[model samples]
Target: MGLRSFVTDILPTTLHTRGRHAPTLVGEPEVETFAQLVDKLGYLSREDLKQVRAAYKFADEAHLGQFRASGQPYITHPIAVAALVADWKLDAQAVMAALMHDSMEDCGVTKVELIERFGSPTAELVDGLTKLDKLQFSTREEGQAESFRKMLMAMSRDVRVILVKLADRLHNMRTMGAMAAHKRARIARETLDIYAPIAHRLGLNQLYRELQELAFSYVHPWRHAVLHKAITRARGYRRDIVERVRSDVDKAFGEARVKVEVSGREKTVFSIYRKMREKHAGFAQVTDIYGFRVVVQSWQECYLALGVLHQLYHPMPGRFKDYIAIPKPNGYQSLHTTLVNPLGTSVEFQIRTEEMHAIAETGIAAHWLYKVGTKSSANPAEVAQTLGAMWLKSLMDIQRETHDASEFLEHVKIDLVPDSVYVFTPQSKIMALPRGATPLDFAYAIHSRVGDHCVAARINGEPAALRAELKSGDVVEIITNPGSRPSPGWLNIVRTGRARSKIRHYLKNLEHEESQALGEQMLTQALRAEGMALPPESAPEGTSVWPTLLRWSGNRNPSELMLDIGLGRKVAAIVAKRLAQLMQEQGQRPDAVTLTLARYAAGGEEAGATPPSLVVVDGSEGTGVSLATCCRPIPGDEIQGYLGRGEGLVVHTGDCGVARRLSARDKELWIPVAWSEEPVRQFDTDVQVLLRNDKGTLARLAAAVASAEADIHHIDMGDEARGETAELRMRLSVRDRQHLADVLRTLKRSPSVLRASRVKPERPPG
Candidate 1:
């Protein structure tokens, strides 16, 4: 028989009679059994069914004799998942992929083979679904993170990948009863943390709730059982109330001459459990456990029915929300209100149109139901796709900025949270953000450039701190300075992942650039000690010198080598020595007179003895150089530089006890450093004072420090004075050692002070 004739004529008959009425079958009955189920849907063509059958046969053969933990044929699991995808009305490719999703992972089926047989789209879907178990990782979490990252990337590219994967996960979660307790708990937690949130984000509300229910059952079985029993008893007692509310709502709508459908909507067990946990209440205290869903014919009718319901029952104060005007981030729209029933218990009602009801239940899956022409002639599939598109773009944006797999996953998890607050821009455009987001997050949401240059903000026409948390309906305006850059402190205040990633990316790039410049300066000083000039890559004669040096150092490029040197990953003197040798080989001999003078100035260069290169500290080196907090060295403090690995340069006081201990073991990492003629910024150092317990002692100390032109960054005072004296420790920012000495003298002159001195690390015992 022909393909169409077989499907149209024989398939339905065979399905009815369980293959007894079949005329002829082209594949195994097991494959035909599933194909027959899909054929009954009348969604796919005969050609599509043929391809699906081919995939099933191939997968079944690949997983031949394999059984699940429940001892069911492995092929049965794939069949069930494929049936779920078909229920979604996805394309034939998705259905085929669902059937063979585990073939590549469990069986030896190769993507190439699948590609040759079923085509590229189906093969790619299977490949995207496969986990990264075969590869090795240092930790199990790392391996799982990488696998999830790959799947997210794939899903962002093709939404169907996730659709099929969710179906697969749903089936697995359903059959998890046969697995070991520990394994079930682990899978349940993963589903709760990742998969369930993803589903909710995608607008797959039905799948989301089901996954949450299943995961909660596995993660906390005892709680689930207790909660289930409580809900069961509550349902029996509340059955009359539910019916009465339904009847009353029906009559109210009828009297108002509106066409509507009223149905009893009960909260899912998981939702009820969550509410109890969040509110710290028992089951009886959860008044909105039983609700009603009013489906109207039109958006206008939805509002009209809302009025009828309010007149029927007393509406609860501050319990009405109009989401239709401002839909949720996931595109869910409804009018929610709570009312006190006759029994004095709260009853919630969700009022929406038929179309909104569909979206509310199915989310993105509602796209299929709205594909045809509707009253508005707008395709909800496009609307759903648009909603998903915004988040997908964010995923790509975050991926571009973050290269580490675990870090990317972390950012995604932060974004997957469902609570959001809507605020407005100066132009009246509404922007929805995660709850607890600050004005910096708003700026970053506007644009990365805006975020980088943001200096301050004005909320509701009043000046607001940049770290101020934004509330719904606030009109926020970001103040930008053309020269401003992000500060490291912003990372602690910003709440959104996008802002966090952008700030980190900017800081990382800034640090790298600064490090490169410092490394070049250090390398130049080292080369000068060898009586050779550092070669410039742009110059024709010096091009070979850098490449030769990089090859010898196993570095890929000059920038990377410079960055390494600046980050203290490589010693500048060693690279300079090797470069000098290469330059001499090219017939460029060192100037003997200059070499002698340079060596003499550098304290004599010996084999393996790096001459002390005097690097001036001007207090504006950014992250490439820092003063050790333990020593708190300022200018003119007899300072030495320590090149800590990956920590750039750390300046320490020459006699700092901490520095002395480090120098004992890492003697070679030390380099000589000097103060500049002028310093641009003040340095912070610790100061201690012993003061008599007087009412104005702190005020006198503050006045003393200010009179000496020093700023106290922080102050610490212990609780209550012991005997007659109290010790005070404060961090003060000063210009130099002379300024610190001046502050010490001023502090000692105070009547409340018995002694004052710079706080230093205690020395180790001999």
Candidate 2:
């Protein structure tokens, strides 16, 4: 078929549904069989065909009594999926997997059984396509997330897994009309949100557009029908214009002596709908609905054809793009330009070589197509690698860092956006990132180490913020320092799954380490209070302490025990008392002098025994020690520590009402904590200010706080403020009580200040 006829006829509608009255794929008046499927297997060897036929026969027998909602035999779905896979010219194993993809899910066929019949590779491919319905999940969303995670992990290992699964999903989406409205809508939404984007990311434009169209139709039948009618009427109205453009393009290419095939292209219904939604326009206002593709034999002819088209029509200014020099993230290459016709309508033209054309339509699947066709000089493996290797590897990387299925699914969705911006490294190496990606994302894209240690960035040879959005063609230089690590705040600005995962992983590990350290310190103090030293990790000749302690605590290791203590999962004093008892049984006695000193330091408990030493709050501990926001304790304030379950130690003021309420309940979880003599970090405290209503009054108050060497963390003003005075609430970070007092005095001296005082903690009466 001619290129124009191929695109206009076969490409627009690659998937379709058949009503109950319509004929099946095999034909009317005949049962569904492997005859049509076998016809598409010309690229496979005779041996491969025999294996595929065996799989088909086994699947048919397994599904003998099963029928679909449409009353067709269940085996037809597998056959149809296999035929679609074969159409992509995938290998025999992929075809076989497609033929039996549903066996494990529906017919109780196990992976081992398939492995015994087919090879391990074929069985694995089939297994990867199966859903996770056999496993119990708390929610449907969780189950679906895990199933996608499994399939994606398998696809990362072998690309054919996804090819077969996409075919399966495509076939399912095509026949979804037979399902109930709610089920069809749910599946259609999933296909549109996930499968279609994945198909586009893999460069299977043919399947991508078809899946989108079909999903949109099912998801919004009313809108679909109305748009379908509008598109049909528009096609009829513009038939003469399309023919005129085709003739003019052919004549121009002929006169220029460039060998090219010209074809007319129309946007899919989904794409048209998306454009309308994005532009917020009506159907009649949408322009450039029709386009043309010019396929050539070589890259040089592609440029020549572009020149001829630009000369034949008035090229729209700033509407041209050279994708040949910088292909899309999916490895699609073409030169795109919009030109104005004599009727003042805009029409887009895409010029590409035949190989580019194939890749454009089939994407990564074109690798296999080229391997069988001898259509291009490029190696199939290299083409596939270039097109999708990084993205596939990213899936595994994300899985490694993310364990929760829903979180993993969220990361995958973040990566699925098809739009991208291509930037450069300091060495001029090109890196393509999702649009709106920042310098931190670029750093992670280079290496996780780089992202973890990234301190600053320079874009286009000038200093730039790490969170600055990158642009195409900009050279990004990342500066790394050994002391610098990813901040929890970095998650707010990063735009890629890989960067987000890496940052979260780093923060989690850091939190674990800090928690272990805090737990160790607390345990040491508790042991000291008992007049005993913390046991060594292992003894030279005697029994080791950790194994017995871990066994008693039901922890895997000492660090885990410490983590439990640090996170309030276990109490340090209780564990220390138990350890002391175990040591005393082993004939170890406490020193008299140590007991006397500990008892004196602990204020000499009435029972003539030492209590656990007080925990010191220095404000330097990271996530392992946090101040309770309810009381906002500072260094000079009388404080106590509460071990919140699964959360690190929470420091609160001695008189905090929240602390009193909790003390009335689980009092043992609270620990005597004292402020360090010299804390290294500032603490946040709230202050209320009544000021005159004036424009620059707020600014003056801020300057007063800054003059006193305190920083305002946040400010709040009531919207009901009126008349002469306004109430302002501010959270300020100050060194201690003395520094805060200085800030309050400075603020009270201001002329606009009517009143200023520290906001007292709310203490509800019991």
Candidate 3:
């Protein structure tokens, strides 16, 4: 390995713009050179440096004559970015990517050109860093979010993408002062919101602090200036106390014969501002701002140093934390304590080993900075690798289930938040989840199947609702039922992106399948009316037939045409007539016997009722076909289907006035619908249960529903608790009409219930 890993004299800044007659990279007196960048790659072979230098030449040529806001050659910016990547001792491809990240976006250089120049991996990383300027978006924020999502997805596949992107961002931020005031504020806010949090999540403490301080300076310059003055004044007043404490600590450690390095740690202005806002306190109340970090040689010495410090000062109650025993999710390990010093002031201290200090400072970057020659007892690089790679792998899991860029970013942002709760599994295995995460999130984190089939949860072996928020140290056990499926409401309460994505994926697939089935049924009924038989789409003639039908209907594929028919976007009868013509042209003829049978099967036509196709709802149908909210139709209820445009077949209770209104306005869109005898899924229908005003009435009502084996999906009490009685309105999920009857019977049998009846849509609140 090169000696560059131990060198720390280099300065950090981003790429600079190019000038028309600027000095060459190596020839310039002040500009960063090829040698400077190559020197930081102590871990790489000479060939790697050669490839990195070649990339620099390419970027330098492409950015010729371009000048940044700082009036420097544009090539300098990428060179600085590459230099930072080299600081982490990233591979040659990563350095190449950093050098060319902006070439495609700002220099009109293409990804294809980059691939031919520096290979695919470098091109791919540069592509990830490229913004979405080519695509037109309705909003600027939306476009920005999409670009971030794209970058994160690429970063998930290769951790180096983020490493380079972060370096690029750091460089840009360092030179942000050259930009316009408004632009600077916007960039600073973004750095604070997105980049800073990411640095913290990656355990890049030095980068995190710099980004936060830079952002705070521009985001609230007035506040930052005021805090700076206050801190300077406080330092002057506290110098004597601080020095005395340092002296006492040094003397005590010397007596114990323990070799250690101690340094003064000061709180940043942003942290002070945040504390002021969160605690609603004045600056004077932030007593623990004065702190120190003690770096020892070994783990044993960390504990020994902690004991020495506690002996020197009275330790504050409940202010001790042993992170070395159980490291943070980011792989940060240290012993933290607060003590009352001789001056009656509280001072915080952090204790850790030198290796731990390296990991804490550089995070995953430490892997290359301090690579081992052989397998050691405990490797900080391996620890950071396990934790960082685990998080990166999870991004793939989330992306598999979430297709929308915005939604994917949303999930990732939720995961980036470090405020987490540690919950234990039934086996006592601990897992960290973002705070406010419910049992559904826990189930998904454990396994997607567990979340899909989760019916309930038990916290500390006591029955808990699935939506209950998990607390740290809670022993959570999710109960799974193979027959149970995720609920739409789960999306509202689940705190993790993984759970939300999985649920949405399952629902989307379910809806598509149901829509296809419904569309086929409608098209078949339409074909019968056209004096034709429905042909399989997979057949040779059928394949050609659909393309013809889709052409006439302005659809792209067979599934799209069916989905349109299912969603009432197109009249099935009209499409069927066109399809019949196409089939006839293909030399396929309609069968007389099948046509006659289908005509009879087409609902209520003989009795002069609307002769529309029928749709069967067995509760398993996804959102493709839904029971109308206005009607709340269920099994055993005579129903009619309304194919509203973009709304899959909507089943309405036959007597519904909304159905009548829709039929009057759109007669051709009406269809017949029925309920399956043994529907595998459950349907929610509302009911009003009148109960005598008494305690335990809700428990009794729940018991009755449970006894009938029906689940109460949701319930609402009246606006106010009335005098002698109260009405509990419940939306119950029942399997069939018989199941509904059983639930009503059970409710009526309860001693507390005065009356129980199905809630009609037209009924006014009483």
Q: Count the backbone clashes (under 3 Å) in each candidate.
A: 0, 1, 11
Better of 1 and 3 by lDDT: 1
lDDT of 2 by residue, 542-626 (tens): 2555677778999998889999888889999999998887877777898788778777767756767544446777877777888
Error of 2 at 656 (Å): 3.6
lDDT of 3 by residue, 1-766 (tens): 1112101211112212211121111211332776777667777788987888788888989899999898988888888888888787777888899988898998899989888888888899899989999999888887988899889878766767888888887777777766877898898899888888888888887788777877777778777767767876787688778888888988898898988888777777778999999899999999977788899888998999999999999999989988787677777889999999899999999999877898788777776667522255665434445658767777788888787777877887778876778889999998888899999999999999999999989999999998898998899999999999877778898988778888888987777777777888888878887788787889888888877777778888888888878777788888888888988998878888877767666645676775443666787666887778886887788888888887777888887887887788899988877777677777889999889988888988899999999998899986984778987799998877788988999899999999998878663223
Of 1 and 3, the candidate ranking higher by TM-score: 1
TM per prediction: 0.88, 0.90, 0.83
lDDT string, candidate 1, 617-735, tens digits: 99877777888988788888888989888988899898888888889988867878878879999989999899998888899999999999999999988786466898989999999
Model 1 misplaced stretches (Cα beyond 4 Å): 1-41, 108-113, 372-384, 527-532, 538-549, 577-590, 604-614, 690-704, 719-726, 745-756
- Decreasing lDDT order of the candidates: 2, 1, 3
**lDDT of all predictions, in order shown?**
0.82, 0.84, 0.80
- Candidate 3 local Cα displacement, residue 21, angstroms: 27
Superposed by TM-score, candidate 2 places the C-alpha of residue 716 at a distance from the truth, in angstroms, of: 3.9
Cα lDDT for residue 105, model 1? 87
What is the full ranking by TM-score, best candidate first?
Answer: 2, 1, 3
In model 2, which regions exceed 4 Å deviation? 1-32, 372-386, 523-554, 572-614, 694-699, 717-725
